[model samples]
Target chain A: MEFCATWTCPGPDGPIHEHAAAFDRGRERRVLIVPALFEEQNRTRRLLVETMRRLDAAGLDSFLPDLPGCNESPQDFAHQSLHAWRRAMADATAQFAATQVLAVRGGALVFPAHLPGHVLEPVKGASLLRHLLRARVISGREAGEQLTIEGLLDQGREHGLILAGYRFNPAMIAGLEGALPAHEGQRTILLSELGGGAALWTRAEPGEDAAQAAALARIVAA
Target chain B: MSALASDDTDDRLRAILRDVLGLNADTVASFDADTALFGAIPELDSMAVAGLLTEIEDRFGIVIDDDDIDGEVLETYGNLLAFTAARLG
Candidate 1:
């Protein structure tokens, strides 16, 4: 009944790592999903489960794949780039919906390049930032430090995206700014409260769902 | 919607922005609803965005999630004011 799992698949470059969840394979016509970032992927783990259940009961499937650089899927985190991650998601989509998809939060920045239309969730760049701040806070680092975009660009490029010595592509710095995640799930917004993003995080699994049905009501009603 | 109509909040938001982004400027103007923030602002990266949200939460005493008007309202100084107006209530 629970729908979350991790797997490895042949990628355009090499063995690609992925995470999948079936919202409802048999009855659902659409799949709501996304590929989130490092800490976010871990923080939303539990909430993703709850969200999948909600989608499954509603007869939909949600597929979440760990991006190239994230999770312990035997992939090179340093080699992970935006394009590779996009391709990975595209591959995951081939396995899920033959056609439709939906994603929330930062996932909205990515959608089918060829899809007829997309449904954006309420999540935005700022939302992703919130999750990252929480990550800093939990790490016992001063969450109060106001790290800037320019600063990241400078630092990320200077060291070529090293997170405590982990190699992240410098390009990812700019990509984060331009990410306008799109989805097929009828433009909705997801909010979190106490431990909301806990699930996606390796250390904490979020227990709160800050999303309201009213956000996408207009889209559904239209 | 009207630049948050509060001199106090405006000044506070500037301070937060400067603190979060590590700026030495005493003031920043042109924060409107249509202002493009995602890519235009040099300091407003994903990490800074998170820091800004946390700062707002502590300052305004409100919980912000992705679903909230953060992304849209935060596009510019004006949008932030609008968001602050709504949250201040």
Candidate 2:
């Protein structure tokens, strides 16, 4: 049972629109899924979609809410901040009355502290930023441009620079660089893969891993 | 672990390559101890390297320092298995 859902978040400027793919059973044990950051989010989208489908089969409802300025939201990425994204997640949890959360990759960075949930492949913001910067450099070189991490950050500081196809504002860059996920949460599960599979996010194209998605659903359902 | 045990470990590592690196099962199935990773596989670039390390750390319950990462550790299937086994031991 899938449906499109929307939640309104009170942003500093005005109301922010948040969108989601909901797997609803109207059951008591609903889980909110917070996906990975930026490029990772797009890469892991299929998995999240599949996970939601499987979760419905497993008799548990879940919501895959898009962070503000991402996915189908009307908000602009140029102004999106780590704190706003975090608040949006919390808002989704409350709007859905979700009891648990399942965070993927850098999603843990924005996961609410009070909600009990599972974390899959938790990553620090600094590490994520470093990888993004590396990819930006590679792409820049491939495009015959001499782009450096320092230079990119400097540009971002002045105005939002599009890096790896995502706009990173000065505030967003600074917040993401320094932001760390709070460990004092109701975190109950930690899931990571053990075998050889490509990191889909780094791929030039989007890819899917049914096996990985199935494994995650099974863990969350348990 | 005996030679046979080491062989088993190698097989498992290959599966990890297939799962975490998102390599095709058939492609990874042909990989042996001599199969070059890291620089050899196009998917195993800098970003994938970080993902691979995180996957390895989580799966094996071992911590890998950023400084410890060099070209040698991920050179081949055997090298990765040996590195993991050493940390496990």
Candidate 3:
């Protein structure tokens, strides 16, 4: 569990160094893991880390990088756009010399399309945005304020509204509205394929499933 | 919808609830039409409802309008299953 500087993002100040959770021993098969975005990232982090450990035991090296606005990065979450994240991922892929890629959920939207790998449960950006908007609406109802998804989206498009606690800029919201996971050279692994009860990304809270982790690792290893 | 199709929707809805709420297989299997959902189940919070609706749309290949959503729709297990079946039609 080494925290190593994996890539650099061009910042207003200067080049910003970004770190990653790396399980590297200079193995032959190196994989760059592009994680799910926002709140889903939190729910699936433990599962991804567990999978990384399994991959390590199987003699494979993996690196899960912190995107510009995520994790330990110094960048503002509201300032991050999908385009910037894509560039950051491309930088990580090159810096790590990743031989393959493993994109999880919304991660597929930004993963380097040239690299051949696997995409687990690839989701459309529209769906991701809808989830966030719906959550905000539900929360508003609880607070005795009426809110609608369309109404919130309209607001988000102009001034950028906070959804599910994440500050999303107009560019980020617009980018997400049209983002879709690339599937050309990647194998799409569905939840049914993993034989899981339900995906951790959809869970109400952060949870771990060793069986699910092992299933994913096995697919990646094989 | 045919009887077979309705049964399929019922099964899928159950599976979605189990997966989204992190409910056990047996617990979900035992859920009947009368079982309360949104209020009764601790795991099925408002946030979970968002994920649940998304999953339902994805799995059933149905687009659910926000106007169609209401407390009554999600009040019981049977209501959700029936709503999903109607969408699939």
Instruction: Give per-residue lDDT, candidate 3, residue A149.
Output: 89
Q: Residue A92 error for model 1, in Å?
A: 0.9
Give native contacts recovered, as a fraction, per prediction.
0.09, 0.15, 0.63
> Each prediction's Cα lDDT score?
0.53, 0.76, 0.87
lDDT of 3: 0.87
Give RMSD to native, each candidate.
11.9, 5.6, 2.9
Strongest candidate by TM-score: 3
Q: In candidate 2, how many Å is residue B50 off?
A: 8.8
DockQ of 2: 0.15
Please identify which of the two predictions, 1 or 3, would achieve the higher TM-score against the true structure: 3
| Candidate 3 residue-wise lDDT, A1-222, digit = tens | 464646787876888888899998998999899999998888999999999999999999999998888888888998899999999899899988999999999999999888888999988999899899997887677677789989999999999999877899999999999998886878988877766446899988889988888899999988
Candidate 2 root-mean-square deviation in Å: 5.6
- Evaluated at residue B41, the lDDT of candidate 2 is 87
Better of 2 and 3 by DockQ: 3
On residues A1-222, what C-alpha lDDT tens digit does candidate 1 reach at each position? 445656565665767656665544555355545644565555555555565556555555556566665664567776666666666667666665535554545555654554432343335554454355343332222334554434554676656644423565666645654565554435444333222222222222223343523222222223
Q: Write the per-residue lDDT of candidate 3 for residues B13-84, one digit (tens) a residue.
A: 878887888888899999887789888999877789899998898788889887678887889887888788
lDDT for A1 (candidate 2): 51
TM-score of chain B of 2: 0.82
Candidates arranged by DockQ, highest first: 3, 2, 1
Better of 1 and 3 by lDDT: 3
Evaluate candidate 1 and give its CAPRI docking class based on DockQ: incorrect
- TM-scores for chain B, in order? 0.76, 0.82, 0.92
